[model samples]
Target: MSERVIGGHVAGLITVGAADALWAGLTVGSAVPSASAVFTGSPTLARGGYVLLGRRVVAAVKASGGAWSVPEMEVRRAAAELGAVGMDCRDLVRIGPFGSAPAPHPVHDEGTLLRWRERIARELQKPGGPERAPRDGGHRLSHLAGVDWRQILVERPRMGMAGSWWLPRTVVRLLDTAEHTETQWLHTARTRRIDNAVIEPPPHDGQAQAADAWRTTSQNLPTAPLRPYSGELQGLVYSVVSRKPGISRKVARWACAVCGTAPAAVLDHCHEHGYVRAPVCQSCNTQERPDHLYSNDIRVAGHYTRLFDTDAAVWLRHWHRCPGCRARATLPLPHLAAWTAHVACRTQRPTHREARSSRGRKPCGALRVSWTGGHHAPHTCVLTVVVDFCPSGEHRVLAHVPYREAAEQFRTWLAETVPAVAAVAGPDRIDDLPTHFRPVIADTSSEGQALF
Candidate 1:
């Protein structure tokens, strides 16, 4: 064949092959080359090359059966090609729809083009690029670059000192107000003082006259001095002190009447009768004297006597026996007193129905005993006590018994019931107990028993 005919045949085959490949890659399969590739290449050759390259990439992706989606694969292939060819795909922005002019062209210089291509490839490979395939291929490729296009297009005003030069009047006023408010806050915080007059110093000799004047103004008129106590008065004082079992005349004299701490340096007395009521520490004496003078009158003393008598009767009846097993138990004295007071109050203020109901039904003699593994098995056996009462019930904890005491009680009970087990090993031999009884026996020991 002639050279002219051969050249023409070759060109025709190239055109036909390009058209077929473009149709198959863009329409038949999922993969499609980016518009940037088209814009960067020579109009005839570049378009054919991209179309053919896209076809090959789609085929390879399908053959490999990669996990990557169609768009990801296309992007990877395009980036690799652009990087290898030293072509700036970003220069596509200077062409077509992205540029101001119609029908934009590629840059002429090779070095500049190569640098731009490198930058474009780097941007394309970044994490923030378009991850999913766009529905409208033409618009997405031409308009939305991998980078935020809005930031590039929109003009932002220069800020800080440079912005102050040409800022509008309203903006300047707002800024000034904000600055002033911030300045005032800082100044107030820096200068603020905290008053903490926690300790008082001894008065100087110069201030002795002033202090004396103040004390004189504040002091109440002195009452007649207490007369020598008769035998009857002494008996009355003893009776009142003995009512509260834990308190005695000696203890009352040493401890503060109000808080029950610190040495009792001041003797608090009834101003009207000139009778000493109780000894109190200096702080309590100063703070509570006026209130006590009114509240601790003859009538209040009579009420206290009645309360003590009722509490004494209740204590005699129930303080010696455990309600659960009818066992002789040593009740905590303070707890017994408190419980007696509660029962007395309840009985004094029973409703009409409650009074009638109480006559028929047996009275509630239930007592609560709680045991906890204090230091042993703290996480696992936090509360080992067999709680008999509802936790949410309106009942006060009478006393907190030590874990060791509760454990000893459990050991004694075990010794009595399972004498055979006690015979085989001693009462203290908690490890010799049956597997099922181990948890129960363990509860009675200061040191926890191992399960295994």
Candidate 2:
């Protein structure tokens, strides 16, 4: 039979067993079978027979034969035993898997089985069935301190058969118990702080000095003091130090100059000059790495070193001009600042006076409130810098250095610093350049101003 048919047949048999037990209790003056007893006694072999009986019944059923069939005599004996306990077994014997008949009887029969089903249902509705007692909170604490295999098996029965199915019962039991010992060790290890603790090894004759130096370093570099760097970042620094020449791993563990908080994991250097740059954290290094012009590129590096004295002209000369368009691109600092302020204002509401003025009387004598609460214009004008190199005819922005002071700083870098550097180092030292110079200016005109 198909699994579905078999499952249905098994379900019918359980109902029969329950009904039989109820009948027996009423007729034989015997104690009524508990729900657990009914569930355990039901001969529906496919549905967790091993789980209900624990170990003994599982062994007996397995030893009898394959899961597909059980000994005919064993089935009859089990029926008789259940019958002796006052459970009606006639229906089970007539229509179950152990029954001699080939075909199953109609389940809707108006007879003893039907009455038994009703009686069992009514009995189940009444309270006072078997229940597991509340577990002591202290036992849980004790279990964590040390594992008890017996208690674990009783509480979590699936562990008993979780290993190899063909293995002997004793071996499976042993494996299940041993598995928790490893888990207990892992739990203990997680709770302990042992990463900073050093286990000293016995020193040999010649290595005494090296051992003393190692101990000194270890004593000085306590984990509590190194909270600035994440464990992963520290590991990365150690890896970089081992690979890179001249850079000490110990020094790299210190706080980064650029970020002041994170560890200096990467060795920053000028690609053009082949000179070592100051140590910086990974995040700052990543951000600045993309803008490096050459190995010995001192102009760009100098701008970083002297942040206040930075000139945009010096850095703009390093930018690549598009060969297709022959246009040099420069980012407008003032327009970008206006756009940033516009965006910031878009998130807030306007003053009460502005709100009332903007919402003047409509033609229908009704006031039309500003959709943005008079804080922002209905349409936003985006300010962008157009670079000559855009092959797709799209505007390319360099940086959003808005505000007058910041804009002046960027303009000075482009106009003064770049030319000054070129004057000393020779213009040919700079990368690709247009035949003519383009003046970088801040758009301060009313039309170019950002609309709020």
**Each candidate's TM vs. the true structure?**
0.15, 0.20
**Total clashing pairs in model 1:** 2
Model 1 clash pairs are: 88-117, 407-444
TM-score of 1: 0.15
What is the C-alpha RMSD, rounded to one decimal, of candidate 2?
A: 30.8
For this target, which candidate reaches the highest TM-score against the unseen true structure? 2
Superposition error at 132 for model 2 (Å): 39
Q: Taking the tens digit of each residue's C-alpha lDDT, what string does model 1 give over 1-452?
A: 11121121221222222332333333322221233323222221221111223212111011111111122233344334423322222211110011111222344211111111222223333355334323334322221111112222212222231110111212212222222222222222223312333111123332333233223221211212222222222212322433455453333235444344343433443222222444444333322211111111100111223223433332222221112111212222222222233332234322222344655543233233333342233243221212123234434434443434443453454345444433333223223212221122211111111100
Give lDDT per model, in order. 0.26, 0.26
> Model 1: C-alpha RMSD to truth?
39.9
Model 2, 285-396: lDDT tens digits are 3333221111111112111322223323322322212121112122222222322222222232122323347665321111111111111120332222212223334433
Superposed by TM-score, candidate 2 places the C-alpha of residue 211 at a distance from the truth, in angstroms, of: 30
Q: What range of 10 consecutive residues in model 2 has the weakest lDDT sum?
A: 90-99
